[model samples]
Target: MSNYEKYLETQLQDLDFKEEYDNLEAEYQIIKAIIDARLELNLTQQELSAKTGIKQSNLSRIENGNCSPTVHTLSKIARGLDKQLVIKFV
Candidate 1:
């Protein structure tokens, strides 16, 4: 597990933190997926920014898990990458 994952396990001990963490888990996963997708395509932040119309600095923040992007923003990114955003429940 990652350091962040370990930290979350500890936070889950606290009911309030657990609730908030649970709510944000999906968002975090999406951030990871976005970064991974970019890397898989061997695209630089600058390149992706040009494709997505998002600033490179903002893209850095988003990939670093420091920013929360809206669904529309994510869709823009997906389109730039020649991918589609698909949400699923399991």
Candidate 2:
């Protein structure tokens, strides 16, 4: 494994680190999904911003996990991508 991966793996063995990581897992998943979907549609942040009427800087922050987007914001992004937003408890 790469050094970073190795270090992360070691960190994950710690209970505190593992708990904190788990807490952020959902946020990470959301960020990854947004990024992946955008790429799959071949849309840049700027293009998505124009389509969604959200500022490109805001979208960048959302994609980078630097900010939390509300359900309303997420819905706008989904519509911009010609997608439907579905949230569920699993």
Candidate with maximal TM-score: 2
Q: Write the per-residue lDDT of candidate 1 for residues 1-90, one digit (tens) a residue.
A: 655558757878999977886888887788767866887799999999999899999888887778888889889999888899998899
The lDDT per prediction is 0.84, 0.86
TM-score of each: 0.70, 0.78
Q: After superposition, how far is residue 50 of candidate 2 from its true place, in Å?
A: 0.6
Question: Each candidate: how many clashes?
Answer: 0, 0
Model 1 residue pairs with clashes: none
Clash number for model 2?
0
How far is 29's C-alpha from truth in model 1 (Å)?
1.0
Where's the lowest-lDDT run of ten residues in candidate 1?
1-10
TM-score of 1: 0.70
Once model 2 is optimally superposed onto the true structure by TM-score, how far is the C-alpha of residue 51 displaced, in angstroms? 0.3
